[model samples]
Target: MIGLAATPEVSLADEPVRIRAWGLPPQTAITLRAWVRDEKGDIFHSRAFYQTDTEGKVDLEQSEATGGDFRGIYPMGLFWALKPTTPYRRLIKWDVMGSPFLVHLELYPSVLLVPSEDHLPAVTTVVERWYVAPGVQRLQVRDGRVRGALFLPPGEGPFPGVIEMFGGLGGLLEFRSSLLASRGFACLALAYSAYEDLPKFMPTVDLTYFEEAAQFLLRNPKVSGDGVGVVAVCKAAEIALCMASYLPQVQATVCINGTNAVNGNFLTYGNISIEGIPYQIERAQTTHSGAMQLSFTLQDPRKPEYQDCILPIERARGPVLFCVGDKDQNYDSLFFANEALARARKKGKQNVYLRRYPGAGHLLEPPGSPFCPVSQSPFFPLPLMWGGELVPHCTAQETCWREMRDFLHSNLAPGTKSKL
Candidate 1:
């Protein structure tokens, strides 16, 4: 019989799973395969080779990953890293936030011995989806100011609140906020532009709009914190930092792969005008592997424009977490993080923490998400390269997911911790 150690249902994407096979011929060689489906209904598969001991038993924990894109002993890692054989596309898509996916595993003979049964041994594992937390209220949030969904976790009076913003791609993505709400925090996926009812093109960012979102989160009856936190990625990361600096309601901020300066178009705050560091179109190069490279400031930090573009994040309040990838091809995440850290430190602030992942790419997605290498643009129409190879990319996703959850929970939710 083939079996799994943990429950057939798992909650976290990076949770460890143990698999075992026994009752077969001693010293037998076998192949184990898994199949799963994405929300798009795309079927994906992964297979590995293993050998049973004299006792006719094979424990995946003790086995080495041999024959698949991932060559590690962790079964969960194997499933997370599975890729197609032909063009090597991701075998699974873990981006269906709050939705569950089913997985099937089968054990087949490496070399058929005597054709005993008509079918191979099989087992099943279910990854359950997480919706809003019990008693949590899911509401449509549309005001003259903010446009997004608000998820309020089930609770009595007050709860920590967070305002989530997506990167330059611009549409309001509720996955992160929904997942966070399931973990016991009120989260709002705020959309500023590029979606229905929002601006079609990027505009000069105004902090007032984000400030309005923060105020909205704070006013929620379920929201308990003195000040709300902000979660943002890519270009939005800069916006988060700016909010933390300008808005007193922003008690904390998590900036991922963000720039140190006001990037893209110019940003305004009343009479104070902040200059943006424009992309060096000429310096942007594409690798032969089809990944577009960026002109990060690290390549030339001394450039006169770099100094002029830095944001005054030192004025921000509360703890800040800067998560960045060292191998990012999108921007100089490491350099920008360092600049932010230095600025915070220079201001005598000690709550800033910089978490750097080496060998990882620009795309630091939530846990269980299949590592994505290329992303399509909403306008210009070219696949932008998010850095890092398969192994490190997935690894970064797995770890960063937990880190983000804990950071927000610990800082925002403080006394009340989620069961996760």
Candidate 2:
């Protein structure tokens, strides 16, 4: 007889689970597999080979994988190592509020690197990974040019407020906001473009629109503090910096793998317009896998000709946190981060902070999400390589997420303890 189990079968996506097997043959080889379907019905799976202990037990926390998707004793490796069955597809939780991801785990009697459909599992179990907690309420906002979803914690008279934005794939993403709300924030997942009646492309973004969104959060009755924090990644991170620089209501900002100088879009405010650093399509390198490595496709903002492209972040009224991945293949993230840091410091600004990850990618998502190094990009003709080693990228996500929460809490809701 063989048994498989996942303690606390249901858990938040960021939370860890304990997996173990009992009643297996001592010293026997086995294959453990995990599979889940994305919102598009695309299948993503990972498998690992392990040997049962002398006591005929295998604990993911202690057992090491001898072969398969990943090696070593990473308890949650199966969850993060998932790769899409369809080439170039990236796993995204499109309907985060609708349902949790149903992850199926199976145990096979023998080691099989690529298990066939005909092979039946000796034991199996299912686990649920949730983004929104039970009591969190999600509200769709379409208030006066501010189009997005607002998530509120249960029984919250007031909570730290956060405005979250994603990169070039401009659309409202609720997973991060929902998870933050569950952890005690009144979070707004803002959509700047490419959704509903918003602009179709990044080039048309107006700074006033983001100002309106920030004003909405500042005026919300459920939101605590006089100012709100901004959390953004990729291209949106540049916009967040703009908000922090010009908006007094923005108390803190987190910029993840973003460029210091504007790129791919012209930014406009009331009377000021800044030209973006143009993309040099000729510089894009095609990988052997046919994916495009776009790290060098943008004109160097540090050059004398592109001075206007640099954002005036030194004028920001709040503390800024810049997170960069040295292995980022989206652009030169480290260079951008360092440039921003140097400029802010040269201007005598003391609140700028930089956190560098050695082996992470362009898409630094919340923890427990699958590590996606290469994926199809809407902005390009071929799949894009985001560039990160698996274990290091996963590690960066987990560490950055916790620090982000603490930074927001400490700055936006001073004197309040972070939930982490």
Top-scoring candidate (lDDT): 2
Q: On residues 1-420, what C-alpha lDDT tens digit does candidate 1 reach at each position?
A: 554333345554444556777776788777676666666566666666677788877777787656554565755654655443334243333343445556666677564333244756554444453433446577878876688888877767577899988778777777677777877778898998877787866668888888888888888888986788898999899889888877888877899998777776778877767767666677777767665566342344347856766776777767788999888888788888998889878988778888898888887876655556665565534557777776777778778877887787777755432221
Tens digit per residue, CA lDDT, model 2, 98-131: 8999999999989986679899999999999999
Model 1: residues >4 Å from true position, as ranges?
Answer: 1-6, 10-16, 84-99, 111-126, 129-136, 295-302, 413-420
Candidate 1 vs. true structure, TM-score: 0.85
lDDT score of residue 348 within candidate 1: 86
Candidate 2's C-alpha runs over 4 A off are 414-420
Model 2 global lDDT (CA atoms, 0 to 1): 0.89
Backbone clash pairs for candidate 1 read 159-224
lDDT of 1: 0.71
RMSD of each candidate relative to the true structure: 4.4, 1.9
Kindly give the stretch of ten consecutive residues in candidate 2 with the minimal lDDT sum. 411-420
Query: For residue 143, what is the lDDT in candidate 2?
Result: 94
